[model samples]
Target: MRRIITVEEHFDFPDSQTIPEQTEPENDAHVNPKGNDPALVTTLLANFDQKLAYMDQYGISLQVLSDPNAVASTITDKQKAVASAQRTNDHLAQKIAQYPGRFAGLAVLPLIDPEAAAEELHRSVTELGFKGALIGGVPFGHFLDEPQYLPIFEAAEKLEVPIYLHPGMPSKAQRELLYESPSYSDSLAGMLGSAGWGWHAEQGVQMIRLIAAGIFDRFPNLHLVSGHWGEMVPNFLERLDEFIGKIPTPLERKFSDYYRQNVFVTASGMFTKPQMQLAVTEMGADHVLWAEDFPFLRRKQQVTDFLEAADLTDKQKDQIAFQNSQKLFGLAK
Candidate 1:
């Protein structure tokens, strides 16, 4: 079997205490402030040994780790946000140094201050030797294409690092408008707005906003990645392209062109063959990555079974499983 290199794996920041509390739990396990999931992803204190053991057991040769949530995104205090991001990133850099081959890191950015975020991104890539930066949807519900964030985009393009766009719970206004319910229970509302359905929808919308705002056109070298088969974007590309074709937009190419050139999608724990086939058909084998989503749906054997059962040729399977990440992240030079 080919070595598996997974990028969407997450680990909690070891120095989380330095940062102000930011993330609100979207699940029952986290309803208590002190509670944590032991499954490798959302631990309050990261357990490197357990993670390494799991990887060894499951044959994951490399996992690119990032903070489970946007720790800096919800913190309103600028100083605290910056401190949190810096501390978190430094901690991750240490972990990667400790296990350089087994683990890689994606920097946490203080997006509230875009200029500072740009500086931090450069530092992480140049100084810490990180693979890239991971931005969780938006900082405090603002989209990435806003002018304040242009510097961060420009910096990422200049730095040549991929931006892994992960999901954050929607803003209160957004939740109230689309996901809230007077009749349904709060648990149901949370489910609808988060992992069950709305989280991917929110991520898909954010990518669309970036496309519509011409961020891709402005930063031609910018690369983006999203999990869960691009949050349903690939399936809907034709419709999106139809609309873009009709608009008097600034995009230098059609919507699908951006996807083909700049976007990569990951499995992110959904290991069904049909979905993988659709992703490969739309994005090509090189643009699809393999992920387990970890802890949230921590079932490695299921993924193993699905991949073994998949109809893709050996070359295609090798590309999605490891080779694509190796090239995109420059893991093999």
Candidate 2:
């Protein structure tokens, strides 16, 4: 059974270290990698507070967050890195506990090392009682699909916690490949372009690797969710199946089967009706959930449009809003 889940969201650290203001030129090849301008974030959080209060008029619950400043450079080493991540999550968990009605929390993880991430996951869930982890779109130096990070996936499998892949500026190597001229063009790719594309491409690529590499097959219960209706799953299911079937040799199982069993996606930034229908048809109503990019103050249109657009049964709508999340958080049946 699916229930309602409204994910109140916030972003990880932004492009450069300048919080709330731009010190240098916006150009110069994107100094602040994450694009979360601090001054902007502060103003937005205030707006988020107002919006959260306003949502009550419409009967929505806000799932709050204390995401780590995932700007890789900011959180550099051991003492400053892991401990700060834990402290932030611990604080957010405390906040959520205070307003149990309007809250559930996601941990912003520092995935510098696999063991470090494993330790933090345990602490966030067992001690501080976080709902799950939110990883930036790409790990600092590696893509989520890279085989080097299997131990991290193994840990999530053991913990039975979901990880949300929020967007971030892409790694240097990634930006170089997609655009014709990194020297002339920008990684920002017009501000929000590459981050959006990266999330979509990265999720699809990683999910394929997880399925193809036999990670999901090995850890059947490991729950993974990404932002933007899984980027491409909604529209590309048939093509994925067809390609896999046509080239089925090394892969042990059908491509469609893995998606049906292992993946979940959120309505965090996607606000289109066509996309909503495609997501429901491919991923199933139960597999899709809602997320409000809280501190960004993205706007109310997504909230209203998603509620109206999804081809959800009443039970499914309930799940997308609340219960689906409950299950992911170990809070539901």
Candidate 3:
């Protein structure tokens, strides 16, 4: 069997730092009231040893762990956000130290302050030895394309680290316009505005916003990683190029060119062959990475089965399974 390196696995902040009210429903079965899967909650809160057992069972060799909630980004208070981010990264680094070869870390930045965020990214990489950073969603209702956030991108480029853009909860206006309705239950509406559709769509739009705002042109060598099969971007690249391509811009390359050059995508629990094929076809094998979105999708058999069954050559499979991540994050074999 090939060595598997999964990127997109997540860990939450220690309970002391977590605010119960702000915690998302998906992470708690009791709060969700709809998807009441206690097993998932258990898995999410599982210990490092427990996580390793599951990974061992599933043939996952190394997991690049991150904070799923992007906790610091959502914190409105600057001091609290910075402190939380430091605490979170410190906790993750301590955990990674315990199991040296079994785990790697992606820092969670306090994007509430872009300058502070850059400094934290630098600290996490230089001091904690984290592979990269993960920015969950729009902070303060602003996309990363905004000028205020340029420091974060610039820091990332200088550090030679990638930022994993993960899905975040939608805002109130978004819910009302696209998901909320009198016809549906609150839970159903919430689902519609979250994982079911909204999250992926929002992430896809953020990617476009970054491109249109000239983020790539400014920081040409900046690297980014997107989850959930490129947040639906891979499937729509041609359509994006077709429509956005004609728009006048100061971009040096086509919209798709930036994607191919600067972005990498991971499976992030979407394990079907068709999705895998689409990502590979659009992004190439070298640009793809494997991820199980652990704790949420804890099907040991399914993870191993999908990669084994996929119609890919040995080299291609190796690249997707681990090589791509090793190259991207400087992971050891």
- TM-scores of all candidate predictions against the true structure: 0.91, 0.80, 0.93
Please estimate how well model 1 matches the true structure, expressed as its whole-model Cα lDDT: 0.79
Q: What are the RMSD figures for all models against the true structure?
A: 2.7, 4.9, 2.6
Clashing pairs in 3: none
| Whole-model alpha-carbon lDDT for candidate 3 | 0.83
- Which residue ranges in model 1 land beyond 4 Å of their true spot? 14-45
Worst 10 residues of 2 by lDDT: 19-28
- Residue 109, candidate 2: Cα error in Å is 2.0
How would you encode candidate 3's per-residue C-alpha lDDT over 190-234 as one tens digit per residue?
777887888888888898899888898999989999998899888
What's the C-alpha lDDT at position 298 in model 1? 71
Error of 2 at 56 (Å): 2.3
The per-candidate count of clashes, in order, stands at 0, 23, 0
Tens-place lDDT per residue, model 2, 210-286, is 66677666677887776677767657667877887886455666777777667788776567777777777888878
What TM-score would you give candidate 1 relative to the actual structure?
A: 0.91
Query: Mind sharing the TM-score for model 2?
Result: 0.80
